[model samples]
Target: MLAIDFQHVTKRFPGVVALNDVSFNVRKGEFHSICGENGAGKSTLMKILSGVLTDYEGDFFVNGTKTGFTGTRDAESVGISIIHQELNLVEELSVAANIFLGRELRHSFFLNEAAMFAESQTLFDQLECEIHPRQNVSELRVGDQQLVEIAKALSLKSDILIMDEPTSALTETEVERLFRVIEMLRNEGVTILYISHKMEEVFRLSDRITILRDGQHVKTLNREETTPQEVTHLMVGREIELIRLGKGRQATEPVLEVSNLSLLWPGHARGWKLKDVSFTLRKGEVVGIAGLMGAGRTELLECIFGASEDLPEGRILLNGEVVNFRHPSEAKEAGIAMVTEDRKRLGLFQQMSVRENITICTLPDSVSTGIVHSRTEAAAAKKSIDELGVKTATAETAITSLSGGNQQKCIIARWLRTQPEVLLLDDPTRGVDVGAKAELYQVIDNLCKDGLAIIVTSSELPELITLCDRILVLCEGHLTGELAKKDFSEERIMELATKLAD
Candidate 1:
């Protein structure tokens, strides 16, 4: 029996056709995985299936019966649940409240808070999680929050569950727990539809996989009949050759240096976020920071860029001159720029046009006599779009209308306009697709060859290995080890990253 059957589904937005006659099916009691590049209509198709999108050209069958779900509640009424990639929980509410939101138990006109907490505790027990039901969602870490999302879906008693990039923010141990929960669900005859960019996870858990490209259905293949290489090729419709640095740059003079850097952590158990850390960067050199989730990678970059919540205790040197910047604008004035990891939240101006976002930080350059020049701004935006190969209809298009990769390129272009000698990238390829990742790698390489110094942090070790001349490993706010390119290995990096500080 089929769990879902989507026939000739088409969805359109103002400036783009998101999905064009996409058709696919999921079998009952099977793990079905979907593979695609960014902006390939994977999320749009999922939205349609989960009833988050109602206006579309399609006929869908649920449990062998044709149905048109008007809203998310309508889909939930028929044993369907979805966990979005971006978390959807209220920070001020308790875990149990988020889990039972809008479906509160009642005792003759009074809220049954105890009953809801009990049920939420039971669900957490089933998932083998130690999260307390009454704890505020804000106090929990991102991985725990993801578990709450899973628990919320499980509470619905849905036979069909859809997970979109559920492991994006999870730790390795948390991922193991999630996999066990998935196994339990499958054994109970629940159908799973999973979406992720990680090839290993898709291959390991999926019984069958469907590939999509440019908002069109490409092919569906059984797990044993296909490989990751084939799926990647189908996802981008081309082979991607990532550019790699052959050797370390042999520059002599130091361009940037940090000495005795320490950031205090207030109102937390950990006394410090970073402790007496030091590093140096040279012209034409790329340094990579390797660490686990709370190893102070992002915090270190924030300290250098003058964006940290608290001023750090450190001495930063630029071109052999001691520099202390109190704000990010001052750092930009000193020829330093940073590209943030959280693209949507930190980097993008969603309501503005592509041209406006590209030139927002450098408006002074396009101004004369205290008046902004529209032609100058447009010319700068055009240069960035053309140089970065941003795929957009026009410079006036909305910034949010582009794909994740293109949006990221615009962010980089914004920083490039600052004409900085030092660049800091925090997980530059976090949610980007394979083809765009290759292109970004080439761009970084080219920039380094042109005498730009860079410091990058990434969760994925392979990416750092491919781009960095030297890798510095951090653990518990301490610098554990540093490895040259020749000594680079995942095992070694992981060892240092997990080491506990004294």
Candidate 2:
């Protein structure tokens, strides 16, 4: 039986046509992958199917029966579950509590902790995960948290699963575990609609591939009959063109350097989360950090910017002198800034306005004698809004009102106001739409052209390959390998990233 069927499905948002006359189908017990560029309609289609977006024009059939979901509950009731790219678990709740949140096992009006733990353990055993159900959700790593999410879905007896960029935060070992779970689901006749940017993972796990470009259905190819290069072309809508434009001929100088750089987590495993990791970033260059999740990529950036301890076990030097920063203010004063990975948790002040968010990190520049000049702040905000193209109702509008893409732009604008010589962005484009991705790329390029040294880390390999002048791979919290622009390749980087060498 056909597990999913769509005819002439379409979804639109203000200033964007998310999906246009899209038609597709997925078979029972098949692992299907949807591929597209940054602004491609892949996510839109998933949202419509998962019932996250109920307002759409189309006919959708599940199990060969026509149906339309009014909300997420409607889809979940019918054995449909979506594992979003951003985790949705309650951080303060225990694993067992999250897995059976709404439908808790109870006896005589009392929550049955034993039953919940037993049930959750069964689900974890099935997924081959080792996390305890009693553990607090906040205590688990990002990868482990994702596994909990999967267990929650399985507990629902879901027959159809939709995973959006599920492996983006997973390490290689975690990815292997996820693939094993996927294989188990397929064997049990569960249909999966998987979306990912990693070509190798797509080919390895997907039995069929659906390509979408610019919100339109492009093609559907069988796994046995198509190659990665062909699929790449279909999703890209062009030839495999790689242009390493600013390398080989560019001058290299000690733009930024760190020695014995480290950061300490008060009560964690060791005295320090980062153990003397150090490197030099040169002008007109992009240094990539290729590490598994929890390899201290974000922590390393935090340490460099003085948000965390600047001197954990080592010293930092800008130009040619040692620098110490006890706070983020000190780092900003030294001409350094960082864009955090978990934007909602660490980067953006959620209750502020878009103008305020863009202007918050730059108050000193807009202030005169401890007095904040609204006119000066507004002028600065307007310039950033125009340059970064942040779509908003007005400069005074709330930041929480903007979409995820535009909110990212505001953060970029905020850091731009500081005018730092070295900028650090941790996964700047994760979960952003394709259109916004292209715009962010242009912004990064412009920053590099202005002679600002930028260092970035992303789970997506394509972003690193296409954007970086040089890529650095890290493994197990150690610098593994360095690849110049000419030496970049997915296979080679994977080898180096998994290998240990500084």
Candidate 3:
């Protein structure tokens, strides 16, 4: 029997149709994957099934009975659970508390804390995770927090699970661990509905694959019968040429140099977040940073951009001139710009228009004697939109109206407007689709040809291998190894990334 069936499912928002007459079915105990480009109906369909969008026009069946959930609680009551792409845990709560929240065991008006901790431990054990129940959710890294979310869902004992981009924030090792847990659950008769832009993950874990584009169902195919190229064609309705780095692009004169960089971490056994890290970046070359979570990848970028909480004990030189930036604005003025890792929280002004967001860093250029020049701002925004190919109705449209990939392009465009000598990008393609990622790669390549020095960090190792001229590996706050293009391999990078710090 089919574990899930959707009939004529359609969802519409204020100014857009998110899903239109989409229909598919999942056999019991099977792993089903949904693939689409950004702004496709994948998330909307999952939201409808998980009862987050109850007003959507649809008919759904769970295990053979017609059902429409009224709310998340109703969905939970019927064995439906969803782990959203953006984590849904309260940051300040303990792991145990988060797992048993709203469903706390009580003994005559007293909360059963011990029982909740025990139950949470059992769930973690099932996943073979070693997180402590008493640890604060905020204290955990993104990968660990993801595990906590999985544990919370398992505690519900849900027969059907919906995971949307679950591995988007995870390290490769953590992703492998998650795949193991998912396989175990599938063997125990749980149906999984997975959504991801990653073609490899979809191909690896899915028994059947569903494709969506522009709010409409394209097709559904068995995994064994479809290739990644075929799936990519279905997702974007076109063939995308993969981007490659220019060969023989060697580093020339150093544009930026870091010497004896070190950051002290106050609350750890290891006293430093970064220990004597040193590197040099040249004009027209892309450098990549590789590391596991908590290995100081983002922190290194933050320190370079002057956004770190604590200043490092080191020397930074730009064009052979010693410099120290007290803030990001100072760094910007010195021809250095950083596109932060967390775009939603740190990179964008969610409520502002695309034009405003793009021209925010270059406000002086758009002002004349204390008066703002709207035309100049609009023209600059339009130029960036055109250059980056940001899909939007107009420059005046809210930034949030665009998809994740376009939003990232907007962020990149914002930095490009600054015309920096050095661009620091943190996980530039974290949640982007293959088509959009290719576009971004093309942009990066063009920038490099124009002599803009770039430094990028990504969780996906293959991305670095494809885009970077050189790769630096950090392990436990230390620079363990560096690999050139000829020596690049996932196994070699992982070895360096997991090396013990001396």
250 in model 3: Cα distance from truth in Å? 5.6
lDDT of 1 by residue, 1-502 (tens): 9999989999998878889998889999999999888888887888898899999998889999998988999999999999877667988999999999988889999999999999999998887778999999977656578789989999998999999888766645567778999998999999999988888889999999999898899999999999999999999998876465644456567999999899999986989999999989998988999887778888899999999879999899999999888899889999999998767667999999999999999999999999999999999999999988787878999998787668989999999988899999988876677777787888888888888999998877888999988999999799999899899999999899999756
Candidate 3 clashes between residue pairs 3 or more apart in a chain or in different chains: none
Candidate 1: segments with Cα more than 4 A from true spot? 91-97, 105-148, 247-252
Query: Which regions of candidate 3 deviate over 4 angstroms?
Result: 125-130, 247-250
Overall lDDT per candidate, in order of appearance: 0.88, 0.81, 0.88
List ranges where model 2 is wrong by over 4 Å: 12-16, 121-132, 224-240, 248-253, 265-271, 309-311, 348-410, 432-446, 460-502
User: Model 3, 310-347: lDDT tens per residue?
Assistant: 88889999999988777999999999999986676678
Output the number of the TM-score-best candidate: 3
